[model samples]
Target chain A: MAETPVRFGILGCANIARKVSRAILIAPNSTISAIGSRSLEKASKFASDNGFPASAKVYGSYDAVLDDPDVDAAYVPLPTSLHLKWAILAAEKKKHVLLEKPVALNVSELDAILQACESNGVQFMDATMWMHHPRTAKMREFLSDGNRFGKLKSINSSFTYEPGLEFLQNDIRVKPDLDALGALGDTGWYCIRAILWAVDYELPKTVTALREPEFNEAGVILSCGSSLRWEDGKVATFYCSFLTNLSMDITALGTKGNLRLHDFVIPFQENVAPFYVASNSRFVELSIGCEPSPSEHAVTTDLPQEALMVREFAGLVGAIKGRFKA
Target chain B: MAETPVRFGILGCANIARKVSRAILIAPNSTISAIGSRSLEKASKFASDNGFPASAKVYGSYDAVLDDPDVDAAYVPLPTSLHLKWAILAAEKKKHVLLEKPVALNVSELDAILQACESNGVQFMDATMWMHHPRTAKMREFLSDGNRFGKLKSINSSFTYEPGLEFLQNDIRVKPDLDALGALGDTGWYCIRAILWAVDYELPKTVTALREPEFNEAGVILSCGSSLRWEDGKVATFYCSFLTNLSMDITALGTKGNLRLHDFVIPFQENVAPFYVASNSRFVELSIGCEPSPSEHAVTTDLPQEALMVREFAGLVGAIKGRFKA
Candidate 1:
């Protein structure tokens, strides 16, 4: 018999939810079971617009979605402030949780959500979609190669976008009450994650925030940067902002090799992602030029990165469900 | 009438002198007249090895090169400590000076050299070769385009190279008594210059050195970095080291576009150079990917950057000589 698909109940009608809901629908092992909003009309419209199947239900409140017996998982696309409450409640109702990035305001709140999921025997995952991209794994292979890349020496990452004046004034991201961390939480999170991932999750010995981060009238960070150093001489720096043109870059330099990619967060093309790498580069005669220049490596994926993320999360949810039945 | 070529006297037989001597010979407006070292045999060997013209004079003492009436300009490639003495003496001797980078130990010594050059009516320039690359001018054109690049926001640069054990143990750059600034002076100079160039030579309001710079056993910095902030909210960070793979990168992000180059200090190829630029890039439907990907721009040159540097410096020297004669 074919395996059962992971049924998802989405909490809130967030702008990001539209993308993730589409991803869930595209993912082979996942399907939208229900969607809930503060207003029933809004939830109903979201379900129809997102092409949720006729069997999918619409609910007026988040509690009603969690109360549905057929909902195997809850995708929480709520604001940062409401993450701790809704995520824990969803876990308590024995539903797997897929939380949006800047998962919680702080580690303690995230820990509470993790603990609740552990006790209820449900899976939890942050929606860092890039992690699921095939290109990420290929880049990891190059970084881990001792002969090609050697020891990690330095890394620099930047993620920035210009979202316009109206969004700056009205978006929940810039509002202190809705997303206290603002640009740092939204954009800087990816930079920090990329640094950590490059170093195989080794925490830096020291992290110094670059002086005078830019802030808005509401006191939310508009732009910020930081430098991190490890005990073994590895160092990294990152900049994130909502004030500049759309740019996502990561450059990692090792003892014998270097890797660079301009569109690390969201690639310029959905079908193929490219990165440039140089190994054992040396200046030619007269120091006029490098003997071997960097070469571009493009990795293609059949499924979109977000859809791959949904599939991975649903696969884990299915395994957990199997364990519970056993 | 054809303009007379500027005649150059080299101050020392430093390793870098070989490259500059070739550049002087290749540049149509410049020629090597004489080379000097502490030992006559070493100077003779250097002049012959570097393919200097048969008319080129070889002298034992640096003063002999300065005294040579045929030498119109002096290329001082001596150690950083020796720069203050030789550059000032060269300027006083009425020879135009092309001093190697990290021109002096500090500002006071540099100021004294500048004062000598001014009083003696001699031209002085640091040997920063990449500034003369044709590609640099093309990149500048993009950066200065308001509609394309907009306002400068952030810049990150890194120039690093691993020169092997012999260099680490014996090179003048690592010796505290010779080049006290070590990697910061040798490599970091390029990074700092690149940042300033991106901002159109405007000095930063504040500069904070990143903590815990790596130091050699003789108390010379082997690796260092700093963050610079401007009053207008522009920020820049740079890292330079002698302990990593050969890499020279500059990534400058503006409000409307970004510019990136993997080899900014030296082009990866002598005949052509490239930089990447993305202007007005935006996400496609559903934020799947950027609509317009960054495009690579290649600028070709008939002469190598070093040769172009020699030509530019020689042209300035000729102009100054004409002014004095008039």
Candidate 2:
């Protein structure tokens, strides 16, 4: 028998919601049931522009989406200030929460959202799409191998893009009232997450921020960097900027080998990604050149990473519902 | 008409001398005339093993090599502590000096060597082979283009190698008396040089050393890192180690583009080297992927980088000799 597809109700017609809504339609185990914005016309236009299914409802207010009986899950891509209010309300309505990155303005707000989800028995996940990439899993295998890539000694990550003058002047990311964390929260989130992922999610013992951070007139960070040191002498450094050209890179060096890739956050191509690895690289005779050069490993995926993320999230929701029915 | 070749007398039988000797023989404008060691037997064996010309002289003492009339230049690959003595003597003897890196124990010693070379009108050059590679010039062109790669925003470099336990225990790089600066002077030199090269040799306004540097029992640094900031908000970071797998990388991010290369100090192959360049990279529809992805540029050279270094030094010596004779 085919399992019932989890129905998703998207909160707000945010730009990112267009991508997630498409992912819901593509995932076999999920479907878009409704989309709500502050205005019915905006929601209707968004649904029409993004090609929402005819069965999907459009709501004028976010509350209507939460109240919809067909919405088993709510994908919240609201501004940072509104995440705390809407995410908690969705959980209380017995809706699983798929929140956008920078889940909340602060840790306490995130904690409150988590508590509400636990009490209401609703699943919660941040929409970090790259985590579901098959290439990430392949890279992880190389890092976990002791003989090929021993204990990681150091890592460096950078995520930067020149979003142009119009975005810099008008984007919510640059406004202190909307996305307060700015580039640090928007782009640095990936860099910090990458470092933690390389070390198996172990928090660094010490974190020192690099000096000379560039900030806009509204006190929003335009560029910044930090150095993190682990208890076992492992070191990591990252730089995130809104003023540089697009570049997402991660370089992890180990005692026996190394791993490097330029497009870690979003691959150059959606279906295929490539990473370079070198093991036991040694200088050739007379030190004229290296003996074993790094080789590129390209991994292909049938579905987009966002679709994979949705499938994984919907599967979890289905398991919870099955347990309750049993 | 063929210009007179620069005849080189190599001081000491250090392992590095073996590579430089071959480069001297390969370079069209340079040739090995003599080699010196503490023992005549060792000097003769080194000459035979390195396949030096049968007409080349073997001296038991370094003084004899410096004093030889036929020695137009001296390739000094002695330990750091002895650089001040040998380099100054070579310059005073009117022989152009091609000295290895970490040229002195301190700035004063380096100054004395420079003063001697200036007074005697003898050409002086450090044996940093990668500086002479054609690929370095190609990468510089990308960085210099205002439309392609605007003002540099940040750069990160790393030079590391796992030389095995035997080298860690017994190598002169780990000995305080011979090479007190240790990995900082041996490997970090390359990282620092790369950062300077990217920035057009402009000095940084401030430099702060990263914490948790590894040290040997003799108080020699095995691994370390530092962050540098320029007056115009450009930042650079570098890490160098003797305990990690061989990785020499340079990732420079600019306002409009980025330049990245895995083998910066030495190419994976002596004949060809590659670097990646990305200009005006932007995310495609719905930010699913990036467009105008990084492209690789490969440069080929007939002679190895070391031979190019020797040839450049020989050309400089020939020019200086021409000036003196005029």
Candidate 3:
């Protein structure tokens, strides 16, 4: 007999859910038990399209979905402005949560989420899909090797897109309730998270910023340059932008040499995808020829790594069920 | 009749003198009439090698060089550790001055140097060679053109080198200084200045940094990453390293396109270097060329664009002499 799959319920039919739903379907030992949206029609459509099991249900309200006895965990893909509210509610219902990136609109929100999760004894993890990719693990290993890149010197990274007029008109990304969740939160967060992870999440000693008041109507940043100095004298600088055309690059320089990530904003894929390593004044190319682990098939979606993230989430759920043993 | 040339003196037998001395020779209406060193033998040797006229003087003590009435301006290149003391002494002697980069150890020292020049009514300019290059002017013009690159998003720059053991041991760069002058100040300053200048020197709202503690013996940064947010929402990042092998590259991303400068640091030649511009997802080769000013040709040197800087300096001196009427 197969092990029972963890039943997942998604809160809100967020735009990102389109991508997350696909991951849930393909994730091993995980099943979509239900879905909820403000509108019953939307919830039903999402459940039917994904072919949720006959016993699975659809709810008009997020609270109804959280209260479902069959749902073991909740994936919170709410807008930045409402992430804290739904995440706290999910925790109150004793549901494990995988909150979306930016985790919360601000540090205070993050703290509140932390407190809620702690009080309820529920497992919580920020749903930073990029972080879940095995390539990120590869990057960390490369950095830790010490003999490869040497002592860390600086980092330069960017993730930008040309979000067209439709997005400019109605996307919550432009709304005020989110409070500084524009480029810095929506896209720039990836660059920030990458740096934080690369440096073992060392808090920066200082931070200064500039913002485009016109585009950043919510006063979040459209493009920002930040310098972070770690206690060990390691430094990094990163840039994020919302108004520019597409660009995703990360370059790290160290004492002995440097490493370049050609498309850091995206996941590794089989084929001509290439990164470069520089040492002794010459550059060597590291190309992706075979599919990297977490999935056997060639990645086809814009975020092909999403399936791996879901699989990992299922494993974490199993660990929790097994008394927190990995 | 030709206007009287400003008689000049150099106050140290430093490597930088090779370039500056040549500039003095080619500078319109200027002549190198005196030189001084800690040892008379060294000073005489420099004077003899350059075929100084019999009327030209050589002095054992730097003070004697400054005391000469024929010396209207003085070039000082002692050490990164001793720029301020001599610059002040030169000002006291009523001589105009050209101090090498990192004009003072830190911003405080820089401010003091500015005050000294203002108080003495003497022209003072930091010899940041690239800042005076004609190509830099072209870059400024290109960036400012709205029809071109469009709204600026990000900047990434680095300047690094691998000095031999002997150079490293004897170099003032390795010594202790309070101004964080090693990598960040020495080589990194070029990247910083380039970013600052590209953005019209807009003061950053905040700055956070990290430095390598090992190379920063006196706590000077050997490698650093700085994040800067301009008031207009533009972001820039700068990285510098003394430990890495030589490499220099600068990239700027804008809304409409992107510009990549492969060898921004120590460019092969002063004029007509090739760069890549990507617009509308198509890459095009763009040649950035500059006409050598007549004054530049006068000062012959092989340090890429050193002669161009000399010509600009000569213009600045002339402008100041004409009461800031440039």
| iRMS of candidate 1, Å | 0.9
Scanning candidate 2 chain A in windows of ten residues, the lowest lDDT window is A285-294
For A15-120, candidate 2 gives per-residue lDDT tens digits of 9998888899999999999999999999999999998999999999999999999999999998887889999999999999999988988999999999999999
Worst 10 contiguous positions by lDDT, candidate 3 chain A: A286-295
- Model 2: per-residue Cα lDDT at residue B272: 99
Fnat values, one per model, are: 0.75, 0.78, 0.31
lDDT of candidate 2 over B1-326, digit per residue (tens): 68799999999999999999999999999899999999999999999999999999999999999999999999999999999999999999999999999888888999999999999999999899999999999999999999999999999999999999998999989999898888899999999999999999999998988888999998999999988989888899899999899999999999999999999899999999999999988999899999798899999999999999999999999989878879
Residue B120 lDDT in candidate 2: 95
Q: List the residue pairs that clash in candidate 1.
A: none
lDDT, residue A59, candidate 2: 98
> Which ten contiguous residues of candidate 2 chain B have the minimum total lDDT?
B317-326
How far out, in Å, is residue B130 in model 3? 5.1
Alpha-carbon RMSD of each model: 1.0, 1.1, 9.5
Residue B317 of candidate 2: its Cα lDDT?
97
In the range B39-115, model 3's lDDT, one tens digit per residue, is 99999998877666677899999999999998878888777667788888888887888888777777787777778
Q: What does the lDDT come to for candidate 1?
A: 0.93
